[model samples]
Target: MKLFTCTHCGQLLYFENSQCEKCHYPLGFEPKQLQLFPLVAEADGRTYRLFGTTQPNAPTYTYCRNHADGVCNWLVPAESATQFCTACALNRTIPNLSEPEHRLRWWKLEIAKHRLVYSLLRMGLPVVSKFEDPEHGLQFDFLADASQDGGQKVMTGHDNGLITINIAEADDIEREMARKSMAEVYRTLLGHFRHEVGHYYWDQLIDNTPHLTEFRALFGDEQDDYGQALQRHYDQGAPNDWSQHFISSYASSHPWEDWAETWAHYLHILDTLQTAHAFGLSVNPAAAPAELGLQAAITEEPYEISDFNRIMQLWLPLTFTMNSLNRSMGQPDPYPFIIMPEVVDKMAFIHKVCQQAGSSAKAAC
Candidate 1:
C-alpha cells in the first residue's frame, strides 16, 4: 500500500503499474526489494535485467506467467525456474477468460490479491502455494455463479486453505447490491480477499499454537457448531449490542467469523497506517484540547511497531480525519467500522501473533 517510484524516470508509480508512463520503461515488481524497477530484456530475450543495480552479475528476472493475461505485474527471478511469482502460483482456478467481461473481472480480482499478498509478505508470514504443499498450502478460486452454468452458486468463503470468491462481486452494481442486502456499511474486493485469507492464516499460524487459548477466550470458542451458529445468526440476526463486541454484524455469526473479521480489520489498519507513514501523514487539530490526545504522528512502519496501543492511537485519529474528508467530498466514509474496546483486544492478539511469526521467521533464517 506504500507509494512506489519508477527507478528510471522517478515517476510516481502505483503498485499495479506495469510500465512507467513518463519514461515508457517496462516495470516489474521485485518482491524481495519491495520495489518497482525498470526492466531491460536480456540477450536471450526470455529474462530482464533490472535497472539501478550496479552488481556485475545481478540476477535476471521475468514476470509471472499471469502477466501475459495482464493480471499480474510481479517478477520471479529467472534462475528460480518458477513460471509464476509467489502470488500468482496460489491460483487453484481462474474465471474462464473466453468471455470478455470475465477477463476484466479477473484483472480486478488480481489487483486485490496482489495487495493482500504484499501485506502478508511484508509481515513475514508464510505464503506457500497449494502446489508447494497440497495438503495445507493456500489456494484461490475465482468462480462464477450458478447462472453462468446451471450449477451451485459460488460463495465467497474459505474452507481449509482454499478461498473461493464469487467473480460477480467484481462488478460494482453486484457488490453494492450484496452489501445493501447484507446491511453492511463497507464492503469491497480487497475486504473479501483480506477476510478469507484471514481464515487461511488461522490454520497456518494459530490453529494448534499456544495462542489458541487466548484466541478462544477473546473471540469466543470456535469449537461451537459453525453451521448452526450461522443458521441462528440468519434466523434471528445479530445481538442488539453487537457493535460493542464485534467488528461487524456478520462477525457475530460465529467465533471463527469473529476472528476472521478482526483479523481482516487488523490487516486494514496495518496497511492503511503503512500508507500513512509512507506519505508522512500526521493528524493534529489545533482547536482540540490536549486532554483528548487527538494528535498522532506516524513515525514508523505499522508492521515494525510492536505496541498495539500506538497503532490504535494513530489509527483512530487518522480514520476520523479520513471520514470527515469523505463527508466534505459528498462520498461515503472509506472506513465505516468502529474499533471498540473488545475489538481492540482481539486486534492486539492478532498483532502479537503476527509479530511472533515474524520473529520466528527471522530466527530460522
Candidate 2:
C-alpha cells in the first residue's frame, strides 16, 4: 500500500483511518484518485466535498453503506446509484453483527478485504461484484464455524468466485495455533485474501483462455485431482527438496495451489515494494562490504516495471533490511520465505499474467 497523509495537516494515516488525527478532519478514500481526501460536509448533511476545493463543479462523495458500521473508509461519488464502494460490494455474507465478537471479526476481515481490493484495482484487474455477475464475479463470505455457531466448520478457501473465510482466522491466537500446526512460515488474513483471490483470477483470466496453455506449462497441469493431492500431502508431507521447486510446503499439494501460492507472493512483493518506494526506502549500509551486493534502491513503482528481474532485485534487498529490523526487535522476520530461482520463474509467469490482464483491461477501456 502506498503511504497516505492527511491533506489538511499532513498527518500520516493508515488506510483505515476515518479522520486525520492531527487536524481532526474527516477522511474518505476516493478509489478513482487512490487518495484519502479530507472531507468537508455539505450543508444539506448528505454529501461531502473535498477539503479545499471551492468550485461548485467539484465532485462530491458519500461513504459506502458499510462506513456506518466502521468497516469501510472508501467513498462512492454522490451521483453513483450503488450504496457500496467497489470493495464493500464484494460482500455476500457478513457474520451476524448482533454478537459483539462477530462485529470485530467482520471488521478485521473487511480491513484485509479492502486492502486486497485496493491491490486488485492497482493491478487494473476486474473488480466486479457477485451482484454484478452472479456466476463469476468476486464475493466474500465471512462465516463462523460449527464450534462457534450451528453450521459446518468453515474453511478458508475459494469456490468458483466466492471466497469463504472462517471468522476464527481473524483471532490472533487461533491463527497462530493453526500456523504452527500447519508449520507455515507465514500466514495472515491478508495472505488468505490474496491466495483465494488468486483462484478467482485463475478462473477469470486463465481458464479456457489462451493463457491456460502457458499456465499449464509453467505451473504444471491443474487437472490432477485436487482433493487427492491435498490428502497425499497431509499424509506424507512435501518432498524433501520442495523449496527447490515450490514456494511453500502447502504449495506442493497441487498445481492449482502452487499457482495460488505464487500469485499471493507476487502481490506481496508488489505491495511491499510499493510501500518502500512510497517511503523512498533504500538499503545502502555504508559499513557493509561491497562484495555482499547489499546496495539497492526502489526508484519506481514495482507494478510499472515489466522486468521481473528488476522487481526481484529491489525485493531481495528490501527483505534483507526488513528482516534485519524485525530480528533487531526480537520479532519474526517480516518475509520468512525464500525466493529461489525456480520460485522466481513461477512468479515471473504470474507477473506476465497480471501484466496481460492489466493491458487487456486498458485496451477495453
Cα distance off (Å), candidate 2, residue 146: 2.2
Candidate 2 worst ten-residue window by lDDT? 145-154
Model 2 lDDT tens row, 227-285: 99999999999999999999998998898999999999999999999999999998998
Model 2 misplaced regions, further than 4 Å:
148-151
Which whole-number lDDT from 0 to 100 does residue 283 have in model 1? 91
Candidate 1: 10-residue stretch with minimal lDDT: 145-154
TM-score, every prediction: 0.97, 0.97
What is the lDDT for 203 in model 2? 93
TM-score of 2: 0.97
Q: Quick one: best TM-score, which candidate?
A: 1
For each candidate in the order shown, give its overall lDDT on alpha carbons. Answer: 0.91, 0.91
**Residue 105 in model 2: lDDT:** 88
What is the C-alpha local distance difference test score of candidate 2? Answer: 0.91
Q: Write the residue-wise lDDT of candidate 1 on 1-365 in tens digits.
A: 78998878889998999988999989999888777889988889889989876687989999899999999999999988689998999998999999889999999999999999999989998889989898889999999986545788888999989999999999999999999998899999999999999999988888998989999899888889999999999999999999999999999999889988889999999999999998999899898786787788988888889999989999988998899999999999999888899999999999999999989997897
